[model samples]
Target: MKHRRSIELQPPAGYAIETERQALATLPQWFVMHARCRACRHQTPIERRDVIRRCGDTLSLATLARRLTCRGCGNRSGNLLLLEKLPRD
Candidate 1:
């Protein structure tokens, strides 16, 4: 089946080393060094199912990428703390 890509070029279809680097650049050293949730200030693994549940299915690495919205605050991570890490290729 053909995968779908969002306008921003993210969504399983968005996996690219450069794209991942750009995504990582948006984050701070503390986030990459320490690693934590941009939402609720919760320091946890992004791989956790609950985190995925909170961020919605589109945030998944399995997908290309999408706008991350918090279920609790109804806020987007684009505005919230963007704690990003470079994915190893």
Candidate 2:
């Protein structure tokens, strides 16, 4: 008999993703990225292709967060990036 190790679906608290590859590894096709503003509690979906195109694949999430601005409040402070799985049809 053979056994396979279970994969971790969720990241631990204060988990820092150093690169896009680390964050996207084993991510399902239904999962999409979003940026949530801490100051105003605003959330918006982000296109992964566009981000990779603009920032390249090696950019860290922390650095990307610092680069993003809240569209709702026009705040320049860092926003939280999240990977949310969408419902299937």
Candidate 3:
């Protein structure tokens, strides 16, 4: 299956994303985060289902990053890469 990205949903960097209970509100449920922790060089793709269940839209990426610990080496902080959506085939 092919995919098309929805770039407009991307949140601005440097500023905190503001929302009551919906983090990344602009993004759809299919959106996922490919995060790489710079400290331990660990990387993983975070599923939206898990994100919503854990943070429930009340969290920001910055806050999430702070809370995440490198599963590989227990390091903190990482870079988040939002994957583009695949078009329906």
Candidate 4:
């Protein structure tokens, strides 16, 4: 009997992972944004409208992560952006 090899499938072209290449304006209204500090592990919810106003609607989430500063530890490096989905009524 011959052993079968597993095949890996790639996503369609123009497909991107969440948070990667995703802009603020593209986020759905039910999804909430959060900022987490890599150093202290502090997480806080961020307002989408406020972020859009300050950073503009075209700014990617990855770029926003780089610009975040930890309010707890005051760390500027390795900050993360998170998304939370809310249940629809």
- Per-residue CA lDDT of candidate 1, range 1-89, in tens? 34365333342443323434343323333333222335565442344345436655344332223444455555454423333546544
Rank the candidate models, highest lDDT first: 4, 2, 3, 1
lDDT of model 4, residue 56? 95
lDDT tens readout by residue for model 2, 1-89: 22356655565454433445553333456768889999999999988778878778666666677788998999887678886656667
* CA lDDT of every candidate: 0.39, 0.70, 0.58, 0.81
Using lDDT as the measure, name the better of candidate 1 and candidate 3: 3
RMSD of each: 13.4, 6.9, 7.5, 6.5
Model 2: clashing residue pairs?
A: none
- lDDT assessment of candidate 1: 0.39
lDDT for model 4, on a 0 to 1 scale? Answer: 0.81
TM-score, cand. 2 vs. native: 0.60
Please give the lDDT score at residue 4 for candidate 2. 58
Candidate 1 off by > 4 Å: 1-17, 20-44, 48-65, 77-89
Clash count per candidate? 5, 0, 7, 0
Best by lDDT: 4
**Could you say which candidate leads in TM-score?**
4
Q: Which ten residues in a row have the lowest lDDT in candidate 4?
A: 1-10
For candidate 4, list the clashing residue pairs, or say none.
none
Estimate, for each residue in 1-89, the C-alpha lDDT of model 3 and write its tens digit. 22366454554463333323335555554445666777666788777668768777656655665566667877765444445455544
| Model 3 lDDT, residue 33, Cα | 69
